[model samples]
Target: MKKPQRSTAIFLLILSALLLVAMATFFYLKTQRQSAKTSPTKPALTVSTAALEQSLLPQRLSANGAIWPWQEAVIGSEAGGLRLTEVRVNVGDQVRKGQILATFAIESVQAEVAQAQASLAEAQANALDAAGNAEKARSLQRSGALSEQQINQFQTAEKTASARMLSARAMLEVQQVKLKQTRLLAPDDGVISARNATLGAVVGAGSELFRMIRGGRLEWRAEVTSSELSRIKTGMSVNLLAANGLPIKGKVRMIAPTVDPQTRLALVYVDLPLQAGAPNDPAAIRAGMFASGEFEMGKTMGLTAAQQSVLVRDGFSYVYTLGEDGHARQLKVQTGRRFGERIEIREGLAPGAVLVTSGAGFLNDGDLVRVVNPPMPPTASTAANPVPTKPQP
Candidate 1:
């Protein structure tokens, strides 16, 4: 009987311990459930949105190219084997037509001219004497006083002297032409772009000494793909982003006849506006600068949105549109030419659909979002309200 009582007491102690542990576990689980119910969730993200609208936008084709002179004139020496004595013009010099650009050594040419003149004078005197002798020979020809052989010899001498005079006169004219060639003159009014002529340097004929941009005219040669070439035509307007990040206006002058075999691109010539206003105007565009521009093809109606609203991912374009559930829905869109801060939407978006404009980059498909209204700027009346002059001491 004592052993049975001891076992019963031990069993009661074990049961009581188990019961206490079960109650403790139940209370702990209850507390956890209550805490989960009371805790707050993440707040929705605020974003700016806009409604897509259809509007008339200009159709444009974009291309990149380098600015170049319309015509580059090569200035060179016309006389060979002459030492350059003076180089009057330098690179970047503005020169007029017929302006002397350089001078060659004229001392040797002057000496040749003098020699030619002396020879010509001697020939004239000899020719005069020969004419008198020929006249005497003709007078004696009818008389027997002069033999036939002697008359023939005198006539031949006269002809020989006359021919020598003619040769000397031709030599003198040749020397005069050489003297004039010792100076290099500008062929047209232009700005010098390059110069290689050096003082005292002997240059050959036809060697380039300077390069000029004719009439200070610059042109933009935009290269476009072969397929886009047909859409562009002469007389279309163009707007280019210049080297200095300023806009330049131009017009399409011509289209290339053939396309490049390697790049499959054709050249579109655009004539840039001439520099106007102050010479130091910050808007001056220069040659050899790489610029990007757009050709205005025409106008058409297209759905448009802010540039930031469109996102590019994996070579595809998308826009996050707002839905009735206050969530963003990622919709793929086909984009076209961009104008200013707005871009054209060719497809996948309908007019009057609300789109996330500001924070679309951070949102994902079906992500919760809160549309935030833009803050109104302070008015002049509010700005003029002073705080009662702060009751100064």
Candidate 2:
């Protein structure tokens, strides 16, 4: 019985030793599997990078604006009559100062002028006869051939006839002058912006018949908010972008002294330059068209970057600065006016600071990033010969 029990104990010890070896192997395999799963298989992604550049950016302001004329004139008829003649001028027609535009039928006016001349001649004759009668009466009275009462009566009759003829003559002259106003003439050298009078149309006195923009000097009336008033001034340079995307040069002519009570906006006037080749081209710029004006406050000192460098979500403008731990950090920044391809950064970034210029749209705040080409400091030699340095360097 003692031999059997010893054998059983030896078997149990061997079994315990085998179980320990198996447990150690399983743990080693588990550790190997975990390490393999944690390791990344793909190569790191690289992105193109550029060094922060220092340059002078413009301090400017942009506002919603529109085009307007320097002075607008509404042409109308001076006298009321049926339109009989339109002498060549129409919409978009360039006219000189005092050039006849249209005419009304006033056939009776010609007759009235002739009648006035005849009446004037008759008045002259009557005045001569009255003077002669008065002289004769005086002579007769001096010779005692006429009584004082009779002489006075003759003098009064002659004076009454002379006054009647003078009154008739004056009435005739007024009628003749009114006839000359039948013709419509251009008040100044300008283009006819609109026309309301047509052939055979009757227009009343002081009725609008044509609208002309005087001198062809067009201007833009831009609406600006009260807060943006100080950023603009008279004679400051501006660039106007039309709806058609054409750029035209202009200068601020006036700033509104008072703000509109309702809209809190001021109308800023800017004079647009005439096209050198064709100053009178009507199709060049039409009034009442919407436009945008860029007020360039000149170049600013400090950092300026491409518009894509800014991340705008909701109302805040921000940028992503890559952290040392390969994570992106969000930074709020103040922005200034926008140029064609770039915008001015007012705050939140310093020179030599690195940022994500592109691919920011795909990144989230604090996301890990693999900078393809890291930003490098400019070596003394590289700074001296920047043109020869490799693009990525």
Predicted candidate 2 versus true structure: per-residue lDDT over 1-393, tens digit per residue: 999999999999999999999999999999999988998444223333344556777776787776676787898877665465655678877789989888888877778778888887887787788878877998898788999998998799789878978887887868766787877778998878888877877777888888887877788888889988887878999888877666788888889899999999998998887561133554466777788878888886666676777889899998878877777778899987665767677788887777777776677787777777556789999888877546785
Candidate 1's displacement at residue 69, Å, is 2.9
Instruction: Give candidate 2 misplaced runs (Cα > 4 Å).
Output: 1-43, 81-83, 132-173, 274-283, 306-336, 356-393
lDDT of 1 by residue, 172-219 (tens): 999999898898999998888899999989999899999998888889
The weakest ten consecutive residues by lDDT in model 2 span 42-51
Among all windows of ten consecutive residues in candidate 1, which has the lowest summed lDDT?
274-283
Candidate 1 residue 96 C-alpha distance from true site, Å: 1.1
List where candidate 1 sits over 4 angstroms from the true fold.
1-50, 131-163, 244-246, 274-287, 307-330, 356-393
The TM-scores of all predictions, comma-separated, are 0.70, 0.72
User: Measured by C-alpha RMSD in angstroms, how accurate is candidate 2?
Assistant: 5.9
